[model samples]
Target: MSTQPRTAVVIGGGITGLATAALLAREGLEVTVLEKQPETGGRAGSWETGGFRFDTGPSWYLMPEVFDHFFRLLGTSAAEQLQLVKLDPGYRVLFEGQTGPVDIAATREENIALFDSLEPGAGQRLEEYLESSEEVYAMAKKRFLYSTFASFLPLLRPDVLRRGPRLARLLLEPLSSFVAKRFTDPRIRQILGYPAVFLGSSPFTTPSMYHLMSRLDLADGVLYPMGGFHRIVSVIGDLAQAEGARVITGAEVTSIRTEVSGRKTRATGVQYRSPDGTLESLDADLVVSAADLHHTETELLPLELQTYPEKYWQRRVPGPGGLLLHLGVQGTLPQLQHHTLLFTEDWKANFEKIFGKDTSVPDPASLYVCRPSATDPDAAPEGHENLFVLVPVPSDPSLGAGGIDGAGDPRIEKMADAVIAQISSWAGIPDLAERIIIRRTVGPQDFVTDLNSWRGTLLGPAHILKQSAFFRGSNASRKVDGLLYAGGSTLPGIGLPMCLISAELILKRLRGDTGTEALPEPAPWSATADSRPESAGRAAGGDAKPLPAEPSSGDGA
Candidate 1:
């Protein structure tokens, strides 16, 4: 509100923090991003070892429109900074006892044909499902995803009222129920129901409202960046700095200092440990925490300023943690695709184990295997392959807290070995284990130490009915007047797109711009009907090593 430069300190150099710092700097505020890791990107970060590069967290670029819209806001486009390659068969879903895996194609006709061959009338029904999903995606983008829950007025809007019935059904109806009502085939149901894992819920429990994920993956199709997933991070960081935002990686904010005036307690600055282990402090007019929400509230802010205590978080269900294995093998594994999902025959049992109170990992577990070398040869040395495997594991208090130190835990190594062996058998590579030249594992302990993730959850909180929308953590602090929250833990919830949207929502609230128009404007290229990207090939990886946080680990990949 002042003509002079208002300094703002943003904790965490993750996607949300970087985006927020850029936007705020563009608005003439002096913004500084404080990231604990040596590099930014949080879970979306990447690391390289033994000439093999691996994206630490998210690899699938499902929501292309979201990324494009973000760059457009920076006065540029993704095409300018990143060469995105569209995966023709978006991904492969393999089932136990099946000789051949089902490839989900980018084109509707190909997918329809694949569905029809498996089940009669299923092809047409698949189209119907996606059609409904498309409508839901559009509606959600307008009325929910891009909007914040700062007021109750938006719920009374004309468009929201008009779709009240449809919204109610989707909100109340389970995804499994919705799919079963339409298709009789079990395989068809499994295929349609798989996207629920992306939001950290089982199809049997997740609301049908989340079926919009199908539109993002099946209809819009999945994509890969030119040089692994970290390219997006490098590009965004450049743009943020170009916009006049200063970045200080390896500076971990230990405490958010506050000043009290009358009854108001406002955040004034922060004390952080610099990369060299020296203590330092930075004064600011406002503090935006894009770090782990729990860590920010319980550790960074004082006890009195804490709004959601440990008990508050304990009651809310958290998304799954991950058992990750990054491998550099001696030879190529032609049986695998760039993006592969190995589904369990008894998927519900796997879900039970994940959500169950027991600390046991799932048996015959569902897993996601990402072979970066499948698309980019440079990801590995000649004739070798770089594989990143992820299995959904429990992140309850019973599990070990995730971090670099916990990465070498014997239990984690044992679990990783079992999962890798299972993947080898499924991929028809009997000697896969023998070919592994380099290996690393990340488990619950790694998540806790790296990102200070509550319960070591990779995707923040579970997107259950009670935790959805306004029920989720607030971006604006309830007690700390000048502090705000961002990232997957806060409003709009989970996924990289949601992180970007969270930044925009926080910016609007800070600027007092409280209208539907506050949402991100569509990129000029994205407005076209046939904006499907061409398949471009390139090398993937860099010298950066894995960071503290990991990607969206709860998603069934």
Candidate 2:
């Protein structure tokens, strides 16, 4: 080992980036994080308005194990640093034209009992399905999630190959198909498939293996920090600082520096514009980019230094985007739950409009509304409520065509009115529009500007077979030797847990931990394979393929 310590410069201070920096610093490496935003958390950032605290992105905290493991790796637990409360009824769903809402409680028995009430025999089916899902989750944690796939041999292990048939079955069936097969009720299917929407894909196309989300949801339970998700970043930032990592926010990286040698074009550092608009250069031994894959690959690095061609992006399926609304109600909402999904009558047709035809809005729209104040009273002032509403919209190129202009867009106002009206009707809360004390809206255009997301996709790429695993943006960049990737867009796909796992996998790869315990290998499925040509450019325009019928969905509630 060299006498000098390893120095790493992390680009982006999002959850994955901060996790990576903190982990690296704990490993005895000198680390520095550069964040373009004024603060950390990236999409999971938080803000305060009129004394109400709201997590701007990622309201639900799922997969507490991921966070626990991360903190444990640094010789601590989140409980010691921050107060975490597990939600009882994880979330509630209000189906279109339904009289009562569906509550997803924390306890497995309660969840089963609730399901049993909806559909006779559903409780037993749910138990069986969860058991299977638990197995898959266990396998994923050991094999696919933790290991780096630089070589094929590790995945080809005997035990993993033995379970290839089961994995293959999961890859071939969609979450909808899987849930339908397991439970006879449409309501159960809807409940099981609800999480997929969070993944930026529909249950009709997402894989069945993603149903493991339900198992993870009930088994691990959903959690929230006292101050919201941003507290996660603050705690991690504190830990990083304690570990001697320098964090510099409001530093916009302009370009990456690399050596001339063709074989060893390692990242030297980055040239960035400071918060004051002054240009400065910082040097490092390695660079980790936690920004969106498109921005990091297409814009930040020099063209000649790029690894994959333009054709790669063309063949890959990018994730979806939407309009986000943060509202502060003047009075308390009696019936509102911590989390709620208001569905439209035509779910399939709505998806087709967004993903298939690339339309601007769904005819009958479905939305996710989160009111954290319901569970945590401190989230809002006494007798007041805080709400975060999200409507899935097409992340098409035309999102900025006069539909979103300085928060005064007529379309946005119309959509917000529609949402509030629907909520009022469902909960019997009269004059919801009149109860609004404060409001903030972020449309698809805002996602593009603030997060640098391609086509304003909230998540990175669609978790289709062709865009997952080894096929996704390589963890280690093809062009830059010392650069690696972690977060939603990279391997392991979208969501907080997956992104955290991505960070761990990339760090292990960077530290040359390739020979550690091998993970289980997924069975060969044509849909899961990477078929795009190397060096695919972003300029090539093509529609994404329909999502695969595999077993994967979005993150937890």
lDDT of each: 0.78, 0.73
Candidate 1 has an lDDT of 0.78
Model 2 vs. true fold: TM = 0.89
TM-score of 1: 0.91
Query: For candidate 2, lDDT tens digit of each residue in 101-202?
Result: 888888888888988998998888888988988988777776776766777677787767999998888877888888887787666777788778767787
Model 1 CA lDDT for position 48: 77
Locate the minimum summed-lDDT window of 10 residues in model 2.
548-557
